[model samples]
Target chain A: MVDIPEHLLIKTAEARAKALGISVEQALAEMKGEAEPTTISKEPEVIDVKPIEVKEAPAPAAAVKADIPAEVDFAPETRVTQRLLTVVKAKPIQKPTSEPVDKVNTWPHLMLPEFISLMAMTAFLIFISAILQAPLLEEANPNITPNPAKAPWYFLGLQELLSYWDPQIAGVMIPLIIGVAAFMAIPYIDRNKDNKPSKRKYAIMLWTFFLAGAGTLSLIGILFRGPGWNWTYPWIDGVWFDDLLDWVHFE
Target chain B: MKNEKIKFRDRVKDISAGLGDSLKESSLWGSIFRPGSPFRKGYSDSPRNRSYVVMNNVLYHLHPVKVKRHAVRLSYTLCLGGLSFFTFIVLTITGIWLMFYFRPTEMAYVDIQSLQTSIAFGSLVRNMHRWAAHIMVIVVFLHMSRVFYHGAYKAPREFNWVIGVILLLLTLLLSFTGYLLPWDQLAIWAVTVGGNMASYTPVIGAQVKFALFAGLEATEATLLRFYVLHVLFLPFIIVIFMAIHFWRVRKDGGISGPL
Candidate 1:
C-alpha cells in the first residue's frame, strides 16, 4: 500500500537481514512469509547442498521414503528414474570376494616347505654325525660272544617276545600276523569310512595298543636286559648307564 | 663407436640366450625337458600354470597338481615318510662308499675295523650310515603309526598300505643282513638268532633255515648270500616299491587329511 524508494527498500531489507543474523535466502523467505522468523541459535546453521555418496553403507529405507514423492503421476520417465534409484539403494555394499575356495597353486606353497624341511633334516644329520662316533669292537672271534649278545635294536622287540612266548610264535608267526592284520589288512578290517580318530575309536585303540606294546618291548630289551640276556637295571650296575650319564655329562 | 659398444652388449646377450636356446633346441635334451617351469616366462600363480609345473617334471610329477592345505601340514604328517626316504638316500650314499673298501670274505671283519679306524672320514660315514639305518627303522614304524592314527589306510589307500608293510619287512631284512656284514661276534650271534627264526616255519622249517644259512650254520656262503641280498637284491626291490609307494600317494588323493 505504501511506496518506498528502491534504494531505501533495499537498505531496509539489508538492515532486517543483518538484525536477524540470517542468510539472505532465509531473510527473503521470511519477508515473503514462506518461513517463520525465530531467534538465532548459539551455532550458525550450516547447509550442505551436494549429496554425500557413501561407498560402504546402503541408504536406509526410511531415507529413501523421505526422498521419494508420496504420490507420483503416471509419467514413464519419472517413475523409471525413481525405480532405478530404489533399486540402486536396495543393495548393501560389499567388499570384493577374495580367492577361490578350491585348487590352490603348489609350486611355492608345497615345494617351499618341503625344501626347508629337507635342508633342516640334512643339517641335523650332519650335526649328529659330527658329535657321535661309530662303535666298532674287537675282530669277529667265533668263541668270545659278548654277554647279553642281543639282536639289532629293531629286532630286540622280537627277542623280548622270544623270552615270553615260543620263538616260532614270537619271532615268526606274531610278526607275520601283525604285519598282515595291522599294516596290510588295516583298511579291510577297519571298514569304517570315517577318517576322524574319535569316530574310529576301536581301530585307533587297537593301533595305539600295538604301538605301545612294541615300543615298551624294545625299550625293555635294549636297556633292561643285561649280561646273559638276564634282566639287569643297567642304571643299578652303572656301566652302560654310567656311560649314558657321561654322554649327557654337563660341565 | 657407439655401434660397436651396442654390438658387444648384443653379443653378450646372444651368448647367454644361446646357452638356454641350445639346450632347448637340442633333440635329446629338448625331448626330455619342458619349458615354463616355475621361474620361466609362462609361469604364474594361476592354477593352470601350477598344475603344468607339476605335470611337466618327472620327479615333481609324483606330487599332485593341487594338494589340500591340510595334507602338507607339518603337524599332520610330521613328514615321517619323507624322513624315511631321506634316511634311505643317506644310507645308500654311505653304503656305496663303504662297499668300495668292503669285501664279503673272512676279511669282512678286518675291512670294517679298518673302516672305523684307518680310512678317510670312514668312521664318520659309517656312523652316519648306521645311525641313518636305525633312524629309518624307527621313522618308518612311526610313519606307519601316523598313517594308522590318521586313518589314511581307508579305501583307495589300502594297496599302498600293503606296499608300506612290504617295505617295512624289507627294511628289517635289510638291517638284519647288514648286521652280519660287520662279522663281529655280536653280528654273528644276532644274525644266528634272526636266521633261526626262519626255521620255525611249520612245514618248511629246516629248508627255510638251510636256505638262509646255506648250510646248518651261518658260514662263508651265508656271508656272501647276505652281502648279495643287502647290496643288490633288497635295494632293487626297495626302489621299485618306493616308486610305487610315492606314485600311489598322489593317485590316492595326496596324503590323507580330515574327513
Candidate 2:
C-alpha cells in the first residue's frame, strides 16, 4: 500500500475525529490501528427510528405467527436489534484509486530545454542581423508605383491566387472564409479521437496538400514573378522580390 | 594574541559567514523569499520542495509542479511555441529601441537612413526587428501545424485551437501593420497592393479600404494609422488573446499526446 500524503491524512483524521467526537490524535492512532476504536455508550442517548414500534416489547418481530402450513419457516429466531450513530463519511482505510502517472518535476526537466532554445534563437537572430541588412528602398512616391508591387511574403500566395481568379474571391472571400474560418473549424470538423499519425491519414493528406499548394504559390510569388507580375524563372531572370534582395545578392 | 596568529583570509571568511547567517535569519529576507525558494536558508532537495519550486514562484507558476515525462522530450514539441513567444519578446525589445529614433511622418525615411548610418546599434536593431518579425510569422504557422499533426486540438482542446488560429491572424496583422512604419517605397507600395485587396470586400469594401488607408490612398495619415496599430493598438489586443490562448493550453491538459 502507498503511504498516504500528509495533507490527505490530516483531512481524513479531522473527519474521523468529528464523527467519533474524539481528539484528532486519537483518530489518527485509531486509523493506524494503534489504538482501540471508540465505542459509543448507549445508556445516555435514545435512537429515534422513524418506523413505529413498541418500546421494549420483548422482540415482537420474533413472535410472528408460524401456523401457516403452506409456507416454510422464515427469518431468524434471535431477538436482534441495531441502531444508527453519527454518520462518518471517511473510509476506514485510505485507498488510492487513481493510477500512478509517469511524471517528472517540471522545474529542471522542462525549463532547461526552454532556456537553451531561447539562447540558440538569440544567437541565430544576432548572426542574421549582422550578415543580412534589412532592405529599405527609396522614400514613398505614390506617383511611382514599383512595377509588380507585392504584398508581404505571407500574403503573396493570395496575390498569386488573384492572377488566376477574380479579386473578390481570391483576395477577399477565400482568405476570410476559407483561410480564417476553415482553419479555425479544423478541430471541430475532425472528430477523430485517435491522435496517432498512421490513424489520421486523411487529415495528414489534406494538410500536406494544402502545404504543397500554398508553398508552391508563395515560392512562385516570392521568386518567379517578375515586373508586370509575369512568370520568369528565378535562375535566369534573377529574383525580382526586393524583400529577399539581400539574400539573393549574397548568393 | 590569537587574532594575530589567525590568517587574514580566514578572519575575512569567518566574518562573511557570520554576515550570511545573520542575513538569512533576518525578517526581511525571510519575508521576500518563500519557503520553497532555492534562495531560502533552509531549502533542501525534497519532493515537497521540488513541487514548491514551481508552485510558489510567480514566473514558475505558469507551469505545473510536474508534467508527463514525455512532454519534456525536446523532439516532441520542437520548442516552436516557446520560440515564437521568445521571438515576439525580442521584436518587442528591438521595436521599442527603433521607436526611440524613428519619427512616423514623411521624415520617416530620412530617420531610417540616419538610423542605419549614424545611430549606435541602430541598423542592427532594425535588422533584428525585421528578421524576427518574418521569422515570427513562419514560426507561429509551424507551431499551429505542429499542434494539428499531434491532434492536440481534439476534444477538450478544440477551443484552444480556435484561440491559436486567432493568435496567428493577430500575428499576421501585427507584422503587416509594422511593414509600413519606415515610409519607404518598398513599405508603402507593398501596403498599397495589400490594401487594394481590402477594396474587394463584398459590401463594406470601400469603407474598409478608406478606413485602413485613412484616405483615398496611402498618405501621411495612413502612415500614422499603421504606426499606432503597429506599436500600441494591435499589441494590446494580441496580448489579451495570447493570455487566453496560454491559459487554455494549461486548462486543456498541457501538450497533447505520446503519439
Candidate 3:
C-alpha cells in the first residue's frame, strides 16, 4: 500500500469513522492494514422484504413502512468509504522543465548593444556640450524679472494651460489629478488584457490625443509666446526663452 | 642550459613571456578572475562559460545569463529605459563634480561664474549635467510611452508601471530642483513661474508655496533646500524605488510580451 500524508490519513480516517459509526482509531487501523475493516452487524429491526438485486425498482408506497436505525449506521463493504489510491513518484511542484525560448547569452548579445548605446549617448552628449553652450545669464535678481518668464520645457505644457485656464484648473489640478494620479493608475484603469495595438484602439487614441495636446501646448509655449505671455511668432520677435538662448541662433 | 650566447632582446622577451604566463597561471590570478571570465587562464568560448559570464559578474548579473532573442533588438525597445538610467548615472557623475565648486547661497552665482572660468573641465561637466537632466526627462517619458504602447504594463507588470510613473515623477523633481543650482536670472525666474503655479494650489496654496520657497518667495534658503533635495534626498528615494522596480521585473518573469 502507498503511504499517504499523515494529515490526509488522519482526515480520511475521521471521515470513515463518522460514516461507519465507529471510533477514528479503528478506522485508521483498518486503513493502514493493521486490522480488518469493521463490518456492519446491526440489521433493521423490521421492514417489508425486497430483493437486493432489484435496486432500480421502486417499492409501492402504500405497502411500505420505514424502519431504518435511529443511529444511522452503514456497512464498510456496502457504504462508500475512502480507498487507498496509487502512489505517484515525487516530482517538482512546478513543471520540472520549461520550453526553451530562442535566446542568446547576455554577455555579448545584450551587453554589446547596451555598450554601443551608452557610447552613442556619451558621444551625443559630448557633441551637444561642445556646440551649444549652456546659457548662464546674469546673476539672479528678483528685482528685475525677465519678460514672459517660463518654466522648464517639460512644464511648458502646464504653463501654456495656465494661459488658457485658471491656474487652479490648469497648473495645479490637471497636473496632479491627470498627470500623476491618472498616469500611475493607467495599468489598473486599462483592464484590456490584449496588448496588440489593433485590439486596443481606444487606449491608443486617448494617448495620441494627450501627445498631440501636450506637444502643441509646449511648442506654442516655447516659440509662439513672447512678452506678457502674448502670442508672437519666433521669427517676428527675437526668441524670448533664455534657457535655449544658445540653441536659438539669429545672426 | 641550452643558451649559447642568447641575444639580449631574446632573453628579455623570454623572461617577460615566462612572467606573463606564470602570473596568469598563479592561484592569486585564478582567484581574482572567476571561472569562465575571459581574464582567467584557460578561458574558452563555451556555452556554459557564456552562462557563467553573466551569473558570476555582479554588474552583469542585472541581466540573466540568456535573454529572449527579441529583447536584444534595438527597434523593439528603442533602448529608452536603459538610456534613462544611463543619463541618471551621467548626471550623478557630473553633479558630484559640480558639487566640489558650487554652494547654495547668495554667492552661488559667483561660484558658478568661477566654475565655468577657473575650474578645469568645469564648464564641460556642468553642460553635460544640464543636458543629461533634459535627456533623462525626455527619455524617461519616452520609456513610459514605449511601455504603454508595447502593453508591457499588463498583468504581472502592472505595479512596475506604477513604480515607473513614480520614477518619472522623481526624475522631474530631480531636474526641477537642479534647475536652480546656477542661481542665474533664468533659473530664478523660471523657478518663480513654477513656484507661482504651486501657489495656485487650493486649500494649502500659501503653505505649499511657502514650503517650496522656504519663505513667501524664492530666497537663498530656497536654493539650499533645492540643492539638498536635488543632490541627496530625491536620488536616495528614487534609487530605492528603482531597486524594487528592477527586482519586481525579474520576479514578474522577466520582460513581458513577444507581441
Candidate 4:
C-alpha cells in the first residue's frame, strides 16, 4: 500500500462526492476500491488531462501563471470530478476584451505644437507687410479707364477664361458647374475606401490637373495679358490699350 | 536681550503667515484661474485638466484637447488652412486701421494719397491689409487643394467641403469689393469689366447687373453697396460658415489621417 497525502485524499473524496451527488465517505470508499486494484496507473492520466483542460479555458486569463493550475489540481483522489470542476471554473472568470490604449494624455503634447505654428505664421506675415505697398493710381474716373484693366489676382483666372469664352460661360456657367461638382459630386464619384495616393491614382490625377489649369490661367492673366488684352509679353509697354474698344467690341 | 529678540521674531512670523493666508483666500486670485494653482503641491495633471484648459478659455476652445499625432504633421497639412485664417485676422486688424484714414467716395483716391504721403504709419497699415488680403486668397485656394488631394472631402466631411467652397467664393467676392474702395482708375474700370460679365447671362442678365451696380453703370450706389458688402455683410457670412467648418473638423475626427 503506497502512502497517499491526507489533503490529496480529502480533495479527491470531495470532488467525487460532488460529481456523483453522494457523500464524501461513500466517494472515499469507492476511490479506495479503485485504487486498491489500479494504484498509480490512473494517476498520470488524471494529472495530464486536468492541466490541459485548465490551459484550454479562455476565461480566467490571470490563471495563466505556471504555478496556479498545478496547485489547483494537485489532488489525485478523483480525476474525473476535478476535470468537471475545471470546465465549470472556465465559464465564470471574466476577461478584459478591449484593447489597451497605451497612449499619453493630451496636455503638453497637443497644445504646444499648435501654439508654435501660430507664432511662426504671425512673424512671417509681419516681415512681408513691412516692405510692400498697396497700389492706388487715380480717382474713380469712368472715362480714362486703364488699358488691360485686370481684376484682382484671384479673379484673374476668370479674366483669363473671359478672354477665351463668352461672359455667360466664363463668368457664370463654368464657375458654377465647377464649384458644384467639386463640392457635391466628388465624395460619391470617387468611392475608394482608402485615401492612399497610390490607391486613388485616377482621382488624384484629375484633381491635380484641374488645379494646375486654374493656376496656369491665373498666371497668364496676371503676367502675359498686356495692352488691348492681346498676346504681349510682360516686358512690352509702349502701346497701351490702342485697340481695347475693338478687342472687347464696346464701340 | 536674547529672549526679547526671540519674541520679536515670532511676532513678525505670525503677521506674515496671516497675510499669506488672506492672499490665498482672495477673490482676485480665484478669478485668475481654477481653485488650485499648478504651482501648489496638490495640483495634479489629468485628462480632465487637459480638456478643462480648452473648455474654460474662449480662444483655446476652438481647438480639440487630444489631436492625433499624424494630424499635426507640418508635412501632411502644410498648415495652409490655419494660415488662411490667420491671414484673415491680420487683414481685419490692418483693414480697421486703414478705415480710420480712408474716405469711400471720389475723395477716396485723395484720402489714399494723403494716407501714403502724410498719415503716420498709414501706408504701412494699408499695405499690410492689401498684401494680407492677397495672401488670404492664395492660401484659401491652396488649402482647398490640400483638402482635395488628401481625400478629406469624403463621406462624413462632405458638407463641410461645400461650406469651404462657399467660403472661397466669399473670399474672392470680399477681395473684389475691397479692390474698388481705392476709387482709382484701376478700381473703377476693373470692376466695370468684371461687373459686365454678369450682364451676359441670358434672360435676367440685365437685371442681375443692374442689381449689382444699382444703375446702368458703376456709380455712387455701386460703391456704397460694395463698401457695405466688403466691410460688413460678406465678413459676417464668412465668419458664420467658418465656425461651422471648424466645428465640423472636430466632429469629423480632426484632420484626416492615413486611410
Each prediction's number of clashing residue pairs:
0, 0, 0, 0
Which parts of model 2 are misplaced by more than 4 Å? A1-99, B1-32, B40-42
Question: lDDT of candidate 4?
Answer: 0.73
Tell me candidate 1's interface RMSD: 3.3
Per-residue lDDT tens digits for candidate 4, residues A46-135, read 333443223355667546755575566534454353332333444647676974423332444555555677788677766765754556
Which pairs clash in the backbone of model 2?
none
Top DockQ prediction, candidate number: 2
Candidate 2 contains a number of clashing pairs equal to 0
TM-score against truth, every candidate? 0.71, 0.76, 0.77, 0.72
Mind giving the per-residue lDDT tens digits that candidate 1 earns over B9-107?
Answer: 343222223346555456775455465464343233455666777888887876777777776677888878988998898899999999999999999
* Model 3 DockQ (Cα-based): 0.36
Task: Please report the TM-score between candidate 4 and the true structure.
Answer: 0.72
In angstroms, how far off is A139's CA in candidate 3? 0.3
- Candidate 1, residues A1-251, lDDT tens digits: the string is 56657677566667888888767667766765688975666553344344444453356765766666868432333211122222356655985687443544566457667767878877877777778765555666656766766777787788899998997798788877875565677778878888987798988888778878988998888778877678877557533221132243222
For model 2 chain B, give the 10-residue run with minimal summed lDDT: B8-17
Question: What's the best-to-worst order under TM-score?
Answer: 3, 2, 4, 1
Preferred candidate (TM-score higher): 1 or 4: 4
Q: What are the Cα lDDT values of the candidates?
A: 0.75, 0.87, 0.86, 0.73
Compose the digit string of candidate 2's lDDT tens values, residues B36-96. 8766776665668778878999988888888889999999999999899899899889989
Q: Cα lDDT for residue A170, model 4? A: 91
Top lDDT prediction, candidate number: 2
Which pairs clash inside model 3? none
Q: Can you write out model 4's per-residue Cα lDDT over B90-195, one digit (the tens) per residue?
A: 8888887888887667677788889989999887788778777878888898998898888898878878888888898889899989978888777788788878
Query: Which digits, one per residue and each the tens of the lDDT, describe model 2 over residues A34-95?
Result: 99989977564444445434354356544553344536533324443555566888775778
